[model samples]
Target: MAEAAAITWALELAVIEMFEHICIESDAKVYVNALAATIDDCLWKIRALISMSLKLSS
Candidate 1:
């Protein structure tokens, strides 16, 4: 679970540092869907990745 979160952070860094376009593939539907949706999920690890992702995009 933490490894998944770590991957999310790594992806965030990759987006922020290098890639202009990125595609992510994963077997974990929950995490994938969570990233796609705008709903508020309060789990800290997930939220951290979400925050980093938004930061990267903005």
Candidate 2:
């Protein structure tokens, strides 16, 4: 869950910095898969973070 939050925070920072290109990698498959999963299908704990990450990445 923390990993997902960090990912979202990093994305927010990147956007604030006006970065045109960036790469994010994580070894936490749980968080990675949670982000890839649909919001409804994701665990409740990380759902909001995943949604935020999606919006930021888009």
Candidate 3:
């Protein structure tokens, strides 16, 4: 679950950095839903940061 979130967050940041929209296709409905829900702040922050870094790299 954590890894999936990280990947999703990274993809989102990348899409943002590219100034393009993103449409994520995933089979993990629970994961997707949880992203919008309040849970695991530390994991979310870490994943968000990683995603931002990935976006900046490109």
Candidate 4:
């Protein structure tokens, strides 16, 4: 959960600044996979942030 929140905040910063590129590194597979999961399937509290992160990926 801490990992998710941190990633979310970083993503939000990137979004706000209109950064063209962003990279994320993690040692936790579960949280990483969860963020990469499809929006429709994810049930985590950070779903909104996950969706935003996914959008940034594309």
Q: Of the candidates numbered 1 and 3, which has the greater lDDT value?
A: 1
Q: Kindly provide the TM-score of model 2 when superposed on the true structure, using C-alpha atoms.
A: 0.86
The worst-scoring run of ten residues by lDDT in candidate 1 lies at 39-48
Q: How accurate is candidate 4 locally (lDDT)?
A: 0.74
Badly placed stretches (over 4 Å) of model 4 are 40-48, 55-58
Ranking of models by TM-score: 2, 4, 1, 3
Better candidate by lDDT, 1 or 4: 4
Pitting candidate 2 against candidate 3, the one with the higher lDDT is 2
Write candidate 3's Cα lDDT for 1-58 as tens digits: 5656555566766766785655556675555555555455335545554444344434
TM-score of 3: 0.41
Query: Model 4, range 1-58, lDDT digits (tens) per residue?
Result: 6777777788878888988888889886666877656677776676776776776656
Give the best candidate by lDDT: 2
Clashes of each: 0, 0, 0, 0
In angstroms, give how far residue 52 of model 1 lies from its true place: 2.2
Clash pairs for candidate 3: none
lDDT by residue (tens digit), candidate 2, 1-58: 7788789999999999989888989987877887777789888888888888888988
